[model samples]
Target chain A: MFQPHADRIAKPLLAAAALVCAAVLVLIIAVIISGAWPALISQDLVVFITDASWYPLEGQFGMLSMLLASLLVMMIAILLAAPMGIICAIFIAYIAPVRVQKIYRFAIALLAGMPSVVLGLWGLTVLVPLVNKWSPPGLSLLLAGIVLAVMILPTVALTSLAAFKSLPIALQQAASALGVRQHVQILKVFIPAASAAILSGMLLAMARALGETMVVLMVAGNVVQFPSGLMEPVRTLTANIALEMAYATDQHRAALFVSGLLLTAMVLVMMSFAARIKGHNDYG
Target chain B: MAEHLFQFVIWCVALLVLMVLLWLVYGLLDHGLAKLSFEFLLSEPQNAGRDGGIISILVATLLILAVTLLAALPLGLASAVWLAEFTATHHFWARKVRLALDVMAGVPSIVFGLFGYAFFGIFMGMGFSVLSGGLTLACMILPVFIRTCEIGLRGVNNSWRQGAAALGMPKIKAVWYILLPAAMPAISAGLILGIGRATAETAALMFTSGYVDRMPESVMDSGRALSVHIYDLSMNVTGGDAAAQASALLLLMIIIVLNMLAYAVTDLWLGRRLSNDLA
Candidate 1:
């Protein structure tokens, strides 16, 4: 129970709490810069962009390939997730009976709530080994993409469900009344209207894939160098930081922070789009 | 004929997507099928990382959730109280603060990890400590706290507020004695979600808390959470393949149960409130 006094003091308390959030941001940025200043100032950002070498002891910290590896993962994962998630939403919203829809929603709720670690373990045992056997070098970018796709499916599915459900129920009924098949009604009416939510969900799913750390750390093979095609082992910024931060020091550690900063920058941009989509959806 | 072609393509895509989702669930079952042992979950990490246990991790997961709740509840509830009961809508700074909190909701966990490592681990000298990780998680999920509480408070009927005011009750007293009670159900679910998020969180904890594979006796003890522990034992033991599989099975079951508990608790609590209103 919150028992606030009827006084200016209560006002000060709120101001103070808000101030704490800013203070946290400031403190975090300061510490990262100070700790990682060596790498930030000494190592050229170009190396991070162009070079493929990432051996920290030798000071070769190029991450262009790793960056691409991450991008490739996000790209493939979204490809795998968005359409299915959209269809799943359609099934739940239009095709399924009420009982099935309830079950689908509950399943989604569980999926959303499941820890990433479990997903990582599943990926490591099932996805990684299967890829390793069929694909060359097995633990390649494609493997990471597939695992990440599953990892983020619930996010995309649930948000798209929200999107499809947000449409006026009459719209679907009207489409059905016009002799449109269930499938046609989905694309012509449901998908278009729900596009914004679907798009935002896709972005959030991509964001989840891009920012995932431990799962990628485990299954992405921890190779910091470039991918030799789709089957080549590679690294991601989140994985790079997670794998090395254990014993990293000086320049090595700061570079990890730089990676973290890069991830946050990307996420901030991604989240703004999420907010914009959410905002536009809210107003609608 | 044109509709048929488009439908063909769409159905092909839909069926492909459906198979992929089923494939995902099958993977979950495949990894976790054999290792659902109560004893394995109750014991500690042992036997050279494999065939040991997940008890330490289970303890750490709950411990982090507890610490996060302790750290966040006071601050979040305080902020919620201000915005809902005390502050004027015309207050520019108050609106800005809420907006900032909303934006904070979007900052990625990686940034929180960096900040946790720097501010709490280094600056605060809570180096690689559980408290640091918990506090970092608290900050990360605070927006959920505020937003949920706002909903709960708003759900309290306006007549309650007016009635309290007419009775010559103090604003602060009214907030505590009347409104919070009515809103308790909604607010409690928010706390549940925050705890769920905290328990499952890893990246933020990865840096601020070192992964000591032992039970934390206090908030300051550095330790690996269940998720981090699962990541470590499974990934770190790739060279010894069998042991990794043993732990993965154990890890998956624990995660399912934990997720279910978190979700059910929130749902039941909220649902009960809604039901009571109907009668």
Candidate 2:
């Protein structure tokens, strides 16, 4: 804490910290590309995407089932989170008193940092057992979906909060001034204006849900085939990689990396898509 | 008439949405409440589905948590201080660079695991030890540290900065001596939250820190953090029957303690001063 020579030391230390953060980022991207590129460039992309069978023993490696399961989880998660997240944001932005809003928002910030393992444990001991009681055996996509919805809620809600705050409050007031009812003002004005942020939030939720590992791995039941319906248990791209990586060797490990490689490419595309939506908001 | 009906519909929607959050809390707590026990805390993993303790995982988890927090705090604060005080806001590139951190936050945890595996585990040849894993975990948690610290540091009033400046202190001194102390409570709040995140991270550690079921002998000893142990136990189902509940309870109890310590330190610090107005 002493500063006799603080100026000289502090500046360089701060610069060095920033440099390490940069190095880590570059390091992460470099590792992913290097690990995955061997599979990406060598194999034909279409056969990987279109073929449903992922049998290592038969020398066939297809990612369709895993991707389908992750997508299914994403679809279900967003279905549950988006509506609630949007509504909660609207309530905080338009309806709640300042004190209440502050409390709610703080609670949400805490939830955002909550560990996935905790949530999965909550699901395993809580939701999975609940589902198990109703069916002969439990563990299904519906259960996983319900768990993930709550998981992604904070991201979507916070993003929607930003969107609602940035919308034209003056226009909202004018609408109310003209006897455009509060709900009418919201539905007609707020939702449309805030769509960009809402969509970005949804995209982010998809990225997270698709990539989520422990929760899905613990609760997803790890069934290898494509899910016939929402209630059937299935394995996701991420969970498959995590579950099998320890035992997987040679082709098995590389195949898993190929899945990771595919997932990384998918997420990169979604991230850029979200960025484009964010950029469009500035011009619009 | 339609507007009135719409308002009713919207309010009902709000109530339903809020109730779902309540249900989630209920689900988490009610199931957890019955199984909470101290015996669970003192045991180690055994036959799948049978009763046992996870003391090793718990110790390693706490050790990694401590290491990551101790390592990340100073760097995080320095970055926040540089951004909120030292740098000019008008630089568009500077703003973009800050925004890039948030984008980094968007990257998946599993992706981070890959990064950690490649760089720390493979490239650096740290070989899946706590040092490599903890460092990787710290990096993953850094975006969180940055965002939380920014929230706290930015909350400091401008008058406080100027008043320190008016007292004939050097500009850096004004920040170091005056503003930082004032911002301390807020930054501590963020630090607590970041530490909590670091403790609970599994994906990032999985790739870097391979599971070692022994006590962490040193920073370099590879160990499985608690979350990964929970995942490992729950999925494989090798342990004995009663142990699952005990293990769950133990994991829950450790996390609850982690949360309380984090909350208590921040709450106490803020209660004496800013009351978390910064966040």
Candidate 3:
């Protein structure tokens, strides 16, 4: 017979541990919001969003440009990565031989696991130079977009592959039996069936691209300007935080926290939206 | 003709994805290999990071990793166990916990850095030390570890639990002896993944663990992490590319080795489990 004392101790201990895990997210939110409280109260919310200039030293903390830069880069990343990722996923799911599929999956996993810093290093040393040849400064919105696309490609591809693989085999068999061509089936049936999951994956990728710091900081040129063109250098909100958090003081520090707060809120929103789509796919 | 072209496009995209991975590895190796030496691994730096071995940085990295694992593993394991066994899938609290973990997982590393700076470095007065950085990383990686571990735990056959109950085994004992052992491969895989994440982190560690490139005498001392060192070398220091590339190579190697170890552990454990079932 089991000792009653053991259950008494183990249950509460495990519960406490779980509570601790949940508390971490709350703690992070609280700290960031509290740190950002100064800017949130002092800076006019309207002006903060409307102002394009970000001269923090001169008391100007307009983050509208950085915010736009973040969104623009993320959009570019998704635009470039989504179709390619879906295609890559389809190739893995339907075209590759079984052994080759395994190898490809492993390679994709390796890519997914690649550190952002290393990718940034590569972008800086190799990609930036190549980009610079076309444009005077290599670090541009376009460059950041490319690096971010590569960063998120694995995420999109893997999730899409899983989505495709999860399709009932009967669907494919029935399609072929009814004289539907493979490409047609993929375009008409398979992708639609997996659309929810694939869409959610892209959303997650967007969130990642939006929040990415090192790659953008290294390759986005950290220029606080509205990117008039793809080749123009721009600073993202994340890059702004990383570049200034060191010497930043008082309201400047608080302003950086506001950037962090904004990023966290955006990511949290996307994550929940993705989770909802995933939940619907699982149940509905 | 259209179908063939479509297929060709897909193939090209796949190849391009593979090429990107190869290009990254090739780029690092091409620039880094000549600089990677035993002496480089064992020595300290001279004139910033331009002329030194990565011994101090390595030590700091290891210490930070140790602190992260030490802080995270117990919490993660317990959280995973509770989620997998104690709570029903549809329970409100369980759903809330899962939601929290998911949101945490999606929060960016830079956000984590800001939180760490605010809470640990300033509020707690840990102030840019290994303890602060490691704790911050522990928080960041907790969701990953817990989710993976929970999946592994849930993947254990329901029959095993039923059989254990039929044999009059205590729940705690059964979990410790049967469930945990069966989940070791997954737990270790999660561990390795978390290690890779923690070690490769730059933004989270940059302000929390600090950018001091000296020998850290204690966890309280600010020390540079390998990833941050690489960032600084490549971005800040003039003529620091050689050491930076070498450091990147080292970090990449560490990640690769950990990944291989994870695979090996999974294979070995799963192989034994298969044989046991057959027996």
Candidate 4:
């Protein structure tokens, strides 16, 4: 039972295995930065980021347009999906019978399981064409955002459902005793209590939308311009890397890595925001 | 009236989401079902994936999954075991490690593709081969497996561990003999979920695995995966729609089956645990 020698080796082996998990994050950022070094060395970071014209061939490596496009789509998608996802979560959690709830949960999991490429294909063949008759050349920021909303709906719904479910049963009972209707109980008690988690869930989904590549690459038209309207095509940081990484060389290749660096940066920032809100909820 | 109206609206949104999901599955089936045949499943593609079946890519996908599991499973389980059994819940470094895993989970698959390109494809001189793709996939899925296994380990009742200790059992033996067997169902579910993720992934394999539509003779050889084949056909190949849809349908079917299995196993585990608790 008291095998000191075996314990010595076993502890370090397990510790090293755990350390590998931590080391991976460090290695990923280091690799990305080294790959992006050439682009970062040549340009002023602010001007490079703020300039809207991204002519990589002509040495103008600005990503303002794509950055804006990523932001615009993320904002619109969250705005569209959050309320619906929360409502659906409420339905599954409260309104549905146990059997029906199981079906709804399975359906959402299936939706979540659908690969991004297949979802992109669906967007291209179905949503884009449908959007085209009303708007010329259906592939646009709006289309991408809509597809993104669909992709992220289950994440938001499932997270929010957990948040809603975590509320103390006494809170619901007390509200009911005070003659609060079911909707009023949800609106006044559950929503208020779960707002932080719901917001954090939405932001987590936003982070996902920002990093998502295939759907936007297929439907966002990959145009390197600021989206003037919903109908206009736009590019994203992810799409920029995916489109150019194949044939790009030297500085151009580094520039694509820089776009990747920017994308990672943006997603990390969004995730930190989500973590902060979630942390606050855990403590308070 | 207002309360009823609010309830009605929630129901409508829920139904609408379900309908949209159904429509997508239907569209994929309708577009690809007619073309699906055993020949399509077993034969190699012709004319750059525009004319024939998806045999090579399907084989490549399975190979990649096998390789990913080989690398990820042991490392992930060891890490999860360390976190759950060796350390206290609030241990400082353990918390930091957990945070890092969480952050890694949020990093996009595309970035992992870039990492594979840099670290494995170029630096390691693997050069867009299945080995590079599989290693990158291992990194991407390690976080998922660790999270699941850690939760599973935590869900084991403390009484079992206490009983082991009271019997003067060695720590490693106790974990290996008692805890791990109990957690196998959940860990197996995690493995299935990891397979599903690897199967669905497109961006991560884009640069790491070469997009050649042939069977890989070795781990060093470049190959096409079903997900990547779908992307390549739809975007680059003219008249590739039918082939792409076929590939998508196959990918969809595999993912659905894996996910359903994971759900079923998890439910079974939970039911058993609940009954045990009552007893």
DockQ of each: 0.44, 0.40, 0.66, 0.67
- Weakest lDDT window of 10 consecutive positions for candidate 2 chain A: A1-10
User: Each prediction's TM-score against the native?
Assistant: 0.87, 0.85, 0.96, 0.98
Question: Cα miss at A71, model 2 (Å)?
Answer: 1.9
Q: What's the best-to-worst order under DockQ?
A: 4, 3, 1, 2
Question: How do the residues A66-157 of candidate 3 rate in per-residue lDDT, one tens digit apiece?
Answer: 99999999999999999989988998899888999888987887888888999999999989989788787888998899999999998999
Q: Candidate 4 docking category?
A: medium
Output the better candidate (1/2) by TM-score. 1
Write down the worst ten-residue block by lDDT for model 4 chain A. Answer: A275-284
Taken over the whole model, the C-alpha lDDT of each candidate is: 0.73, 0.72, 0.90, 0.89
Candidate achieving higher DockQ, 1 or 3: 3
Model 1 Cα shift for residue B266 (angstroms): 6.1
True contacts kept of 4: 0.69
Q: Could you give candidate 1's per-residue lDDT for residues B140-168 as a string of tens digits?
A: 88888888887788767677899998887
lDDT of 4 at A127: 82
Winner on DockQ (2 vs 4): 4
Task: List ranges where model 4 is wrong by over 4 Å.
Answer: A1-4, A280-284
Q: Write the per-residue lDDT of candidate 4 for residues A155-222, one digit (tens) a residue.
A: 89999999998889999889989999998888889999999999899989999999999989988999
Writing each residue's lDDT as its tens digit, candidate 2 over A102-186 gives: 7666556555656788678777766787888877347888788878888898889889999888887688878878997777778
Q: What C-alpha lDDT, on a 0 to 100 scale, does residue A204 get in candidate 2?
A: 82
Q: Name the better of 2 and 3 by lDDT.
A: 3
CA deviation > 4 Å runs, candidate 3: A1-3, A280-284, B266-279
